[model samples]
Target: MLLPSLYFEEGFKVIGNMVNTAFGKFNLTGKTALITGAAGLLGQQHASALLEIGATVVLTDISAEALGAACTALSCESTASRILTRVMDVSRAESITTVAEEFSDRRIDILVNNAAIDPKVNGDAGIQETSRLENFPLVQWELQLAVGLTGAFLCSQVFGSAMASDGRGGVILNIASDLSVFSPDQRLYRKEGLPADLQPVKPVTYSVIKAGLVGLTRYLATYWAEQGVRANALSPGGVFNGQGDEFVTRLTSLIPLGRMAKADEYQSVVQFLCTDASAYLNGQNIVMDGGRSVW
Candidate 1:
């Protein structure tokens, strides 16, 4: 009833090959990665990692010096050949539009939206009460959201349009944080008597802004699916090394992994989501919190 022995063996080999190819590695040889907040700790790691894996990386930051530094570091030896640098203020739509025009006819294969600010709420508290987000200070909440949220949206709208119209779909990875959830012990301000939302254990603006990204990503994912674009968020755990000692200690204790995450640990997930490997995953917030959410 079955096939001959040789045929069975050949069938087995074919199945194995198919499986391997399906789960095998992917390279980004002809792609370009556009990274905002591209000079910060995580940003550099993402840029360097992508470049190492063959993607040409376009790095942008609020500081001209920061962008220069990133380019210099990447271009210094072998890696330098793969980076392009820009100074951008994500808070300004005009700044984004300018860059968009400069890149007029190009397509950005991947976009990492990871810009942010650690603004104080009060004397040290991070959130200033807005009458209804209506009477909010012209500078604080609006400014923070503009950089963290609007900037991401602008990039998606501008760069995404170009990427799709090229008749090629692309990846958009939004860098969110565990603070997008109830960040009890992961505050970011130095002030006391802060609103429950803006405490040092979990900064108000950081949480609110990231939470908004969930919606932005979902909307874009749905909006662009037919166009071959994918959108998703990565909610990384509290990272160690960059933060102050006090904050780091508190965050470490809260982790089920019994330690804070190092920046390098996030590279694989980002690489997967940013490449063809995650081609079908969209509108999802993949948390990398070491099972903290589980506990």
Candidate 2:
């Protein structure tokens, strides 16, 4: 029995529409996402991903010069109008509160707590003392916690409350690390011939800050579950950032995938967590470590 051509075309068109509708769950049209540390390498990538998905990205960093440069760079990929830049010092409550008030009129649907000090992976002699516990300065550890952990807490409290109060609800994506769940393999930071005591190791503060973010994720997830706000953490693996061949090879060997992550690799996961695609995901630390942690 031959169906009418018009009927067949209409049925196929309906199916196509359904698929597009489903795919649209990942779209962030009309939503605004505020990403801290937006001038940094990973922060820029996160902003790009969100902007590509039609989200209005408010890129905030402590350095005005870097933030301006990043916003300019990102403008090449997107319209200047869609990209908003702010000099936000996440370490201070006053800074967070000021930015929060400025954006209070806007409904910020997503917050990516991506600010943190990059651990000095390269064992330079000038900075060698900071990485080891015995010589790790108290001021450095306290400062790391202030920025990485305390910053997240303050942003969640202020921006998150705005989301709840507005009745729109939202998502908070904490940028954690694979170290959040597991201790850093100190061997990766070791130099070949150095004595064990004198060799550089991953700092104690890095793991503590990351682990705290994971704990914060779980707490916020449940704390605001009834208010329609969801919190989740993303624990990404080491990215290929022009490290020495020895470092890259040593790190990749430990991973089942046998390679460091490309810069753009984690963008899709950011899109997922920030959009409706991850509507039910909450309180979970999604580890995208290229199978490193498993091994």
Highest lDDT: give the candidate number: 2
Candidate 2 per-residue lDDT over residues 1-295, each given as its tens digit: 9889999899999999999987899899899999998999999999999999999999998999999999999999997899998889899999999998898688888999999997785566653556789888999988999989999999999899888776678999999999998998888888876666678888999999999999999999998888889999999999998898988888999999999999889999999999888898999999999998887
lDDT of each: 0.78, 0.91
List the candidate 2 regions with Cα displacement exceeding 4 Å. 1-15, 125-128
Tell me the TM-score of each prediction against the true structure.
Answer: 0.82, 0.93
* C-alpha RMSD values across all candidates: 4.6, 2.3
- Residue-pair clashes per prediction, in order, are 13, 0
Highest TM-score against the true fold, candidate: 2
Compose the digit string of candidate 1's lDDT tens values, residues 1-295. 8779999899999999998876555678878889999988899888877876789888999899888887777776446667888888888888888887877665688999988775533334334434223334566777788889988898888888877887688888899877676554434334455555433333456778888988898998988788899999999887776566765666666678888888789888888888778888999999999878777
Model 1 misses residue 136 by how many Å? 9.0
Query: How displaced is residue 65 in candidate 1, in Å?
Result: 0.7
For model 1 the TM-score comes to 0.82
